[model samples]
Target: MPFISQIERQSDYSRFSSSTPIVIDNGGSYFRIGWAGEDDPRVVFRNIVQRPRHKTTGETVTVVGDHNPALLRYFDCTRSGPRSAFDGNVVYQFEIMEYILDFGFDRLGADQSQIDHPVLINECPCNPNQSRCRMAELLFESYGVSSIAYGVDAAFSYKYNQKKGICASNGLAICSGFMSSHAIPFVNGEPVFEACCRTNVGGYHVTDYLKQLLSLKYPHHSTKLTWEKVEDLKMENCYIAPDYASEVKIFQKGDKEAEEKTRCWQLPWTPAPVEEQPSEEEIARKAERKERQGQRLREMAEAKRTSRINELENEIRGLDFLVKQLEHVPENDVPAFLRDTGYASKQEIESNLAKATQSLRKAKGEQVENEEKGDTSNAEKYNLLHVPDEMLTSEQLRDKKRQLFLKSTAEARQRAKQRKLEQELEREKQMKLEEAKRLENPELYLDLLRAKYQELSEKVEQRKRQKTNGNNTNGKQNGSGGVGRGERLNAAQRERMRLLASAAFDRGKGEDTFGRDDEDWQLYKLMSRDNNDDEDDNEADLARVSARLREIDPTFVPKSETGSPAEPPGFRPLTKEDFQILMGVERFRCPEVLFHPNLIGIEQAGLGEMAGISLRRLPSNDEALEERITKSIFLTGGSCQYPGMIERLETEIRMLRPCGSAINIVRAYDPILDAWRGASQYASDMQLFQQQTFSRDDYFEKGEDWLRGYKFRYTLT
Candidate 1:
């Protein structure tokens, strides 16, 4: 593994001459910079930029690379994350690229107004001219570099390995980097771009697949699986499976080998909030506090009652005094005397006194009359009802009519009360009978009750589904489907539709007597959306059955509006194991995406398949040339370092080739830094390096057409 550490600024920048070429591998994942032909890059950081606000200053500052854990406390980076300047290894956003370059150059200890040295950067294969032009413009205008050169990272790694005798001049380079993977066929030491194929599946996709799996398996621990942590896990544990199905079967069968291979990352687990028993003192104090609150509430209620009783007594006394005073006054002077008490006459004063006396009795906790003593009061209350209209005066006749109305209203109310009391008695009798049956045979009664509940619930659910056009609990259509133009409707809605159809079909066919008949006016009510009048009856029956079942059976749970159990159907108690996430199949399963990209929903060719595709695309139909490419197959890039990668690729390519074909899959000396090392070796020769690069004057004079046609010759290196 490459040594990953925080990049420190170099102090020996001035030791290198101005003519020294700076090597930069502007990869999608990381950035590296140093003098050309060096043993290693002097500075390295994640190739990402961030503009986060300082928490104390509230100023947005440009920060490059991964956020340091120590520095995160000083910045509000919630709204921003490490952002890449490349779009799949090709520079697209110049502003972000500028930030990355600034950080890379600063870390390399560039302390000049202009870099002065030539820059050699790596880009993806078949990069567009727009990307090159933008990069060239930025380097020339922003950094003021002496010259700029571009090379593919894969090509550099391939050439570097080829010179080391790891691969032949005519071979294939299978580089699985961060954002994407590539298989480039080489002919006479030059990478064959026409025969190369790229799969948009690499380390990033593998890490993402693993992250998704972890999220699904342990949703509560999402924040624990950061990208960097998952990347580390991938590096530490993930490996390509020799055969996906057979490998998966090992885990599926729960073999000991699978358990041995499974990796466990024990996250920081905190104990759950267990219910602990309280000490005697704690319990006693709690009970005392509760009792004090209850006593205070009771005292408050008692005080309020006493205050009300006193007020009622005072009102009664005042009314009694008014009544006594009115009794002494003359009849003509009675109205004037009562006027001061807001009463018009002696009868009004007596009515007020009677109300106050009744209230005072009630507030004093005395039994008050029910006021519904119709059997006793009816005779005196409607005395005038017995008198004939002609025998009585006009005022008496009016009173008789009012008394008659009141008598009928009172009788109706009494009948309703009697019916309600009889219904209650009947319900009580039925409940007692049901209770006796339950006691006689509890299981049988419960089964019968559950059956009834189930039947009613289904009936109610069907009716509800029809009314809602098959919408589920979420108000969205369920698997059965939604309410389209031909949606099934309830009986009332169907009838309304039938009536509407008839009305529409009758247009110009007969006389329009729609509103002539009184029955025709009822059409609009039936056409209304709320036409299901008997739905409530079915729901009420279902509710009754559900309630009965709940009363008898502890396991019975009521269905919700959508007919699903309000709570989980079976009360399967969750254990700590449910919270734990065990990774068995995922170790090899995630890395298998490089061989089967379809697992991640990407329809691109896999890494091994890309090799086959690249070989088939070669113009040379000679079997010897193809054999040479297969025999010296070289694997480069960070993702190619997986434990079983070479074995898997060998197995995959062996199946595609003819029997006994020479298939040697070799890993790069350093899959990651070899690209930079290759570029360094290529840039060591000043004459050859200068030939491959373009100065600022050359760029403006030749125009973009020349830049589009640019390709560095690795053979010269």
Candidate 2:
């Protein structure tokens, strides 16, 4: 069953007699307090305290234990986390502890000038005397309690259970509490403190260990692994495996039974909506719209061209009329006629007619056929190209030179076309041969393809290395030595370092002849940035292989742009699985420390050893006493609730006992609340009034030393 706090403030505090003592089980995990002789605690809460400044008021408020997380938004809690009074299961910080006690007592209906009733508080075993003294002083000075009694919570629990008839008067009490676990022998209904053992491990360590392992395994989900949530998970799913090695083997081999044992948590995820393909009718409409747009553009261009051609033709006719008029009026009148027609002379008018004719031809979309014309008019345009220079005029000589230039350009174009055609045929033949080989044995062909891809990939990788190496060298050549201070390079970058060092040292040695020749300049060019393309061919080959593999293997994926093989560093997204913290070994591992205190880095005897230690501490070493103690080994405390805890303790204690000694280990009826209940019942006794010694004089005479050594007789009340 999951444990929960009972925090409703008691209303009948004033009704209880003034002599009735208040009992508190102040543990590291929880704080429980109630009137003596009650069957249950009146108030219980987490032992933690928080001090947060109110968001609106900016005043620090003491919040004792866990509350609604949403309400915490009104306070700034980033500077400080929730604090506890305990330091390794012992109360070392009195300030925080005082605040908690104040809250506990206040909620218990303490409205008087001071707490006038007697108080009973639980403390850890072997608590430092300084801490105990401070606690006593605080109660005396501030709260003004009439009297105080200090007792161990585990021992109280053990005694409470013994009275309940759960165990004999003499037995072993293995109490695994919040921050620590202990085993004490109850000899004749009294605890043997000197022989008691403690192990500094409990539920806290178990929860922490599970949280760490889960967070490390699923970094993405770490945010959800809150301490509180992990605690819940630890209590819910965690259990002890009798044998860790054998249990792990079940999971390691992935047995069917292991699958049944394994649990999974599905995180909230919604797949992204996929895009739907456009409808046929929609696609047709789009195509039609595009075609209509193209038609309109074409029509607009044609109209513009027609208008230009008409303007050119009109200008040509006007120019022709002016030329005709000039021919009739003679050469002297030609300039006047040309000027009226926007032409300088007859030659100008002729040039205008020729330009208009060319415009008209282009507007009609007819090829100007300059290259074809050059071929057809070869003899007429460049007649002197075949003739000797001695028989030609200077004008003819220039024409022959122009023809020679045209002929060479046409020859170059023809050669390029032929080469391209031949290369295309060669590629087609190679592709057909590869296809035939694939048809022969598809599986083998795929294997070969994969092998080829791997080879090509390696080559490309090597080439990349070479390029990077070359860059490093060039950087060094530019006098930028050894990369950056903290920069690391792949294998190629390191090789470049070696090359650069060799090149640098090789210079100026037996060679004052460094730049004596032009070849030395070429050496610099070889080492230049542009010369880093040593693996271009290898890259091209890889590209081809990758393309071929993609064609054959449906599963083959080419990683180039976004799928580069580089892992990102740092936290990823958390899943529900991360929120699911499982504890298999942790359940026993935590409580196991009760039998082996060394597990939690604590060098102390465990619970089993503590029983023996307590017996050894006894003033009496009688065999009958030992047997009586072994007969009533009572288990108590919150931690004793584990399934096989009682049996394990019995087995361990029996081992330490004599060959035929009788041993019994029993669990308390209500280990968590029995101590407070028992104390409450004791306080209700009218005789308790006689034990109450109040006033400042009694405390003053008692002194701090006497308060430090104060012990309670639970059975007396």
Candidate 3:
């Protein structure tokens, strides 16, 4: 079950007597506080602290435990993550721990300046003297507690189950807490700390392992696998395997039982809307509208052409009349007649008449191939008679130079056209040869062309991928492009980043003198993310092969835009199964870390090995004592609640013990809360409480040396 906090304030704080002791289960995962002799704690919360800045005040405020997320939006908590008071199961940071206690006591309706009653808090087994002294100092000075008593939570759980007659007085307690696991042997109903075996694998490690595994498998959905969500998944599905190797073989072979055991957690997803094709009536109406628009454009073009033909005819008539009038005048009067017009001489008028005649013919939809076809036809077209400049006037020399430049330009255009026609002839000749070979052996021709087309297509595809991202050379590419860029970068991309950094820092030269040089602009082109200078020469060759294959092989399909194979249209609607995270072998594989700590890279005893290690470390090797301890193996704490934990622990312990050793493994009724209940029950007796507990003056008088040897008596509880 998921853990829920109870931080509501209680109303009856003054109802208890001054001598009444308070119990607090200072667990690594949570903090449970209440008055002694009660069945359950009055207030419980996550033992976490957050110091966030207020949005309006810009001052930091201490927030303990979980609060409404909407209310937290008013604070800027990005500067730090949630801080824990405990490192492993031992409290080291008392400054943060004081805030936790303040919240716990405040929530329990403590409005007074000081707590008049004594307090009982649980700590880790064999906790360091420095940590113990710090806890005592914090309680005595900060909270003003009358007295304090320390105990191990696992020991409390063991004695609580012992009081219920669930196990014998002589036994072993395997308590798996949040950050660590311990196997403590109980002799005469009291825990032997010297024989305890502790491993740094617990519920926290199992949940963390599961989170990492899921994140790596479905990396795109890693953001959804929050610690809280994965913890819930672990509680619901994780379990201990009877034999990890044998259980894994079932899943590896994909047996029917494995499929039955698998569970799935579906995530939230919404299907996108599908587009519908146009109806036949709509298509017909669109085509009709397009035809009417085309008709109007055709009428407008005809009217423009007719108007241009009329203007050209009128201009030609006017020029003809000028020529006739000039012919009637004398040669000397020609200069006088031409002065009225814009022409400099009679040859200039003839030049204008010839150009008008050519333009008029061209407007009548006639070709001008003969006009620009041959260079021999226009040898004298720029006729300055190849004259020397000394024999001509200054104006004549300028005209001759202009004519030479025009002649050269026109010849160059003619040469380019001739070359293009020659290439076209060569291509037609190749096509005829190919047709002959296809007719001779159609099947062979089809096979040869198909092979060539496939090879060229692969080459073109490879070149395209390399140009887009050189890192995609390996097989990390999915349809979603390639591997993400954060973890990796191609050589070109790295260079670009280096250039950008260099430009920003000015190479440590100081002063803002960028963009002064012309070459500096070229640096931006190299640094640009979209700039790809690589050429694709194979694309043209692939197009040629694809076109040839299409001519001979009717079944041939191309991947180009115009010849692409059609896929059935429309998207498949998303289903619940598409978003589900499947738990097959992972359901047991992750929890198997409890029995094999090496799975998570920790070289230590696992949960099952801890029991064997604890038994071996006993001072005496008495068979009867070992048998009694094995007979009443009590399993407690949150991690011990997995489904097959009892059976698996019994099997692992049996292998270490002699033949037919009595191994009774039983779980606590409520592993999480039983320790608190046990502490409360123990603190009820005033006589025993007064003997073990110490006041603030006693703590200061007797320092760390005395606190090191102080131990709680669990047998009396």
**Which 10-residue window in model 2 sums to the lowest lDDT?**
1-10
Model 1 lDDT tens row, 1-717: 111126677899889998899999988898999999898998888888777787987988777775567866788989987788877767788888887787788878895458989999998888888998888888887888999999999899988888888888988999998989889999999989998998888889889999999998888889888899999988988888888899988888887998898887776556567789999999999999999999999999999999998887888788888878877988787666767678855655666666777787887788988476544446555767777777899888888888888888978998999999998999899989999999999989888888888888787867667555655445566455655433445556667777776874375367565566667656676577456556776777787777887676787756674555467677665555555656778888998989989988899888778999999999879899999889889989999998998998899998899999999989999999999999999999999889999887887788667898887888893
Error of 2 at 342 (Å): 18
User: Candidates 1 and 3: which is better by TM-score?
Assistant: 3
Candidates in order have lDDT scores of: 0.83, 0.71, 0.83
Report the candidate with higher TM-score, 2 versus 3: 3
Leading candidate by TM-score: 3
Residue 36 lDDT (model 2): 79
Error of model 2, residue 527, in angstroms: 10
Highest-scoring model, lDDT: 3
- Could you give candidate 3's per-residue lDDT for residues 308-338 as a string of tens digits? 8898888888888888888899988888788
Q: What lDDT score is found at residue 617 in candidate 2?
A: 68
Which candidate order results from sorting by lDDT in descending order? 3, 1, 2
**Which residue pairs does candidate 3 place in steric collision?**
none
The list of candidate 2 runs beyond 4 A from truth reads: 1-9, 260-604, 616-619, 689-695
Write down the RMSD of candidate 2 (Cα, Å).
9.9
C-alpha lDDT of candidate 3 relative to the true structure: 0.83
Each candidate's clash count: 0, 14, 0
